[model samples]
Target chain A: MSADLQLGASFRDPSGFVFRKNGVLLRQVNRPYLESLKRLTDSGLYGELTEAGLLIPHTEVGIENAFSDEAVAVLKPERISTISYPYEWCFSQLKDAALTTLRIQSIAMKHGMSLKDASAYNIQFHHGGPVFIDTLSFEPYDESSPWKPYRQFCQHFLAPLVLMSFVDIRLSRLAASYIDGIPLDLASSLSSSHTRFKPGIGMHLHLHARMQAKNADAGTKKETRGGFGKNALLGLIDSLQSTIEGLKWKPEGTEWADYYSDTNYSDAAMIAKHKLVAEYLGAVSPAPNIVWDLGANNGEFSAVSTSMGFQTVAWDIDPAAVEKNYLQRRADKLMLPLVQDLTNPSPSIGWALRERDSLIERGPANAMLVLALIHHLAIGNNVPLLEIASFLARAGEWLVIEFVPKDDSQVQRLLASREDVFPDYTQEQFEASFQGRFTVIKKDSVPGTVRTLYLMKRRAS
Target chain B: MKKLNRALNIALACGCLLTICQSANAYIDAGSGSYLLQILFAGLLGGLYFAKTAFGNLKAAVVRRASMHKSDDSASHVR
Candidate 1:
């Protein structure tokens, strides 16, 4: 077995590649990229972006243990806790990532450098905002050179954002299909003609797509002959910024978005639920370092977990709810709110299906919180209790879950539209099913509500 | 005759500029052309932004210098 394992997703760029050695991730900067790397560091742009938290910070390491003979230098970047795909991001998260990429590019220009790639995968949400993760994406800016990543930026950022805002918001799922981005042509066709009336859509999307179609017959050339000046590049970035800033997706009228406001829980009941969850978390041993709050509507409980010094990922099915949760995540919050339908989670995608990990591959978190969600998975989605327990068992070592009885108004509401064929959906059955997977540690009823919250540890395999 | 020659030269120059500006090889996609066109239109906006930032900086510098001079004057009087 080789000591170094190259990351599946980082094969495109010849300048550098990320690899793992003894489970420690490191980037080997190729010899060809040495000039660009020096320009990036010596130019002070790296320092500025890293200090501003716009770029991921890295430390240079000795190349004696390089992954390849052509290695110029090795870098160890602060690893992002969990890697998320663009398709999983809410409208606001994608927009923020796009704007962050363009902002970094503009700043790079000021320091006589430019971004070589505009792939959405290059940006990751860190702390409370998007941070550029690929350190080798920068190259020395030439006044005569056009921005090579312009087309990629439009495809990855502009097209998807336009489709989400103007067309159906669910069109963002197209990102999962087309890993590069939602194709410009598809985005242009999906959106109504009314979208052309918007500030940047007509020119950037419709016309741009047409141009791409016209030039489809042309062979790929690495460099186009043109003298694209610095001012022009800056102007392009400004236009993109304005276009993204102008686009907005309001989370209104969604059943989940209005969940907290329309819930049967009284103000006191809500507080009681929160308090019980906090207390249960405190009782857990070895303090969980990472937490996954499944069905975390607006991240109320996720925030509690974050406050307790845990890196929490708040997953919700509704884009609107996820967007709302993300909006509340300021600089102090450690929550990464993402849109994820528990029923159909994000799957392994890209070449060989291993380029991107499925939701489960990235998980088995230290602790998993499934609050007000069991009824939905069981009663709403028709998932068997035993299966749910098995799935949750694979998701975490400790599980803090709520079992909303059939009598609960929320569960009744779910049954209102469907036949009540859930014969084994009783509390006794729920506990029995979980017995095979989890050792129930404690169970308590939330005050003022007919809901039971249970804390359980995974049974030894 | 001279005016005619100058007109011909100007037309040839314009033709050359147009030819060079035509969307480059297959390497540069249509999206790049559309983006470049947008940049050409918004170049003035970028300039305006720089101008606004410059003016703000100038104002701050003037305010800082005036306050510093006033403090120096008070210090000398006290001495």
Candidate 2:
């Protein structure tokens, strides 16, 4: 393939970028980055890091044309795990990911190299913890350069962590709106009163921000400067490591972190629901099976697909819920469980919407489990039933979902505070609206609850 | 008749509960808010430990115990 492949968010990094050709994901390493690439591969550090689950492993593609100039190396990654932006990560996950990035940097520096940039997107969730994705992020240590990625590290990780720890966890949500990492000015404002005087947070965030502002006004940046020596660089990294250590946030709210206690399901019903989902997945047996469990509070149902040998994506809106899911996943060394708010899912916004894909653009899962979700989105969110049916239809071929009747206690509570305008939300009306998009395969009742589970397969148009 | 009554009561209670839970997820862990605060404090300490080099190496050692990150090289499947 030509070097001119169109990949929007991939254009910047001088090390090279990712592009897909004929369905295979490939990363092309540029000529200038050969030294760092050679050192990274030869150091034996890559294998050690990957096997420890601290790095994502890559395979060299077996194509004659894949390799360009002697300098360019084509690598085919086994799979793209979860594409969670920094904003989508729960407090613990973000904190853990930042640590992982810094650890990788420290190790790289030991090998006479360093990370050229500290973009959070370079870190991705894989087998529980965050792993380095950009194989090209490494560069030969230029002793004359003052650790160029320092400001970026602050923008992408440090400031956000400090603010979340000291001020409010919700402040971390600002990352979703600002793709260039969080604005330092905004972080300076959102930071807690105590953070203003905290040495590490103050120096890295407040003072560093002032320096950036002054530089902008002076019309001169690092362009004229030389890099820091060994002692200075180590000092910078050590101070950052200390500052990151000093900051913290504790997970709060029961359902966000511990969802099972208050969940309305009887133990028997929960097991039965999982059994039904398992049966439905075995029945459809779709190829390339990927399952997304929407509103998966703590990932109980999402694990069903993974246990059956399918990749599963567990999504929920609550950060606490995500934090809990990530904790469990880390304990078991599993690879699923992500944070999301379906109502306001991650969108593509950069130089163009085409820079990165929206959530829907990343999926066409083999199956989906919307267990006890429609009622929440329909009654709770006030989304129309017809639209809900249409959206779910595109998510998968075989969907095992639960329909909570208005008479069911959960639905009744949803109706209690508001007018019951959803007269058409009856089972008959639901079947009629969904029949156009799906074929009902089977339906079962939870042993103790009135919630009805429907196994529907998308009908070929 | 008794079974029907129990079911009815559960329905009524769950309905009210769901209605309330819809807005704010005010569910608490264990018992007192103070206990939850303690657990959170511990989690924060662990987060801090990770920032220090000691925690980083310890985590790697534990992960290497069973070669947890090992993946099959010869096997390739469609996703």
Best by TM-score: 1
Residue pairs clashing in model 1 are none
lDDT of 2 at A268: 88
**Per-residue alpha-carbon lDDT of candidate 1 for residues B1-79, written as tens digits (9 for 90 to 100):** 3343334334323432342232223443444454444333443434534554466688789999999999999999999
Estimate candidate 2's alpha-carbon lDDT, on a 0 to 1 scale: 0.69
**lDDT minimum window of 10 residues, candidate 2 chain A:** A219-228
Query: lDDT of all predictions, in order shown?
Result: 0.82, 0.69
Docking class of 2: incorrect
- For model 2, how does the per-residue alpha-carbon lDDT over A230-273 read when each residue is reduced to its tens digit? 55566466657767876766667644476677667888888887
Model 1 chain A worst lDDT window (10 residues):
A218-227
Instruction: Please provide TM-scores, in order, for all candidate models, with all chains considered together.
Output: 0.87, 0.80
TM-score of 1: 0.87
Q: Stretches of candidate 2 above 4 Å error?
A: A1-5, A67-71, A219-227, A254-258, B1-79
